[model samples]
Target: MNLTAESVAEALVVNVDEERIDAAVAIQFKDRMRDLTAGAGGRIILDLGRVIFVDSSGLGAIVSVMKFLAPAHRLELAGLTPNVGRVFHLTRMDSVFPIHADVAAALHGAGHDL
Candidate 1:
């Protein structure tokens, strides 16, 4: 899992550099995300611009992260490749979380004046 993190406006922008987010690496991804937002004080903008696929485990991991964030933090997804986006839509998971076109859009939607 090649991922990078940066602060974008009021959100933590996480760029996933992998082509697929599968069960093999979902746990690690989740852990890293949790660490990235540990002391951060805003929503998380996960930029899945490079991710071309996502399986049920990957989706479940994401949901778990969202659940973990709870009232303390928020999670937003952005730049979902067509295939990955389709999975979310197919499973109706897209409606379970907030999705954005890009980090900037996610930030703006989160009410950050960036």
Candidate 2:
């Protein structure tokens, strides 16, 4: 798994390079995200453009990250591939979190608060 973090506009853009976000990679993904958001004091935009697949464990990891952020930090998802989008739709997680079609949209929706 590979993750890269960069400051984009007012949000932190986390680009995931993993092919799958499943049980095998959940822990690492969660830990990396935690570190990326640490003291950043801004909304996080997880760019899932490179993530081709996601499973229950992956979704759980993402949910855990959001929970960790709580009412303080904000986390949003963007550029979900079709397969991952299907997962989110199947799990109804699309309603639970904000999903954007691209990084620009996600950052804009975050309102430059980051």
Candidate 3:
């Protein structure tokens, strides 16, 4: 749950410093995300570059974050490792989220101030 939140352009960039996002950390992840993104505006980008694995619970937690952001805000995914990216693709979550190659690409895609 070593998540670091920063404002990059018009987005809130959350960097997951952990190597795995599994059952053990799913709830913590969700709670932490809620805390970090509370009352936030615009897009929230999750930088999962350091995360090597993500279990079903983890994915569910992520989805919860997306749902929580709802009407006023957005949740985007960036820096997905190969395995994690495969999981999203296989689960078709890739279509549900705005997946970017990396944080920079995400910013560029949104035309945010780099």
Q: What's the CA error at residue 94 for candidate 1, in Å?
A: 0.6
For model 3, the stretches where C-alpha displacement exceeds 4 angstroms are: 111-114
lDDT for each of the candidates? 0.81, 0.84, 0.88
> Which candidate leads the pack in TM-score?
3
Clashing residue pairs, candidate 2? Answer: none
Local error of candidate 1 at residue 53 (angstroms) = 0.7
Put down candidate 3 lDDT per residue, 52-99, tens digits, no spaces: 999888999999889988867768899899999888888998888888
Reference-based TM-score of each model: 0.89, 0.91, 0.93
- Identify the candidate with maximal lDDT: 3
Q: Native-vs-model 3 lDDT?
A: 0.88
Error of 3 at 59 (Å): 0.6
- Residue lDDT tens for model 1, 1-114: 677889877667888989988999999988987887788787777888889889999988888888888778767788888889898889998887788887767766643222
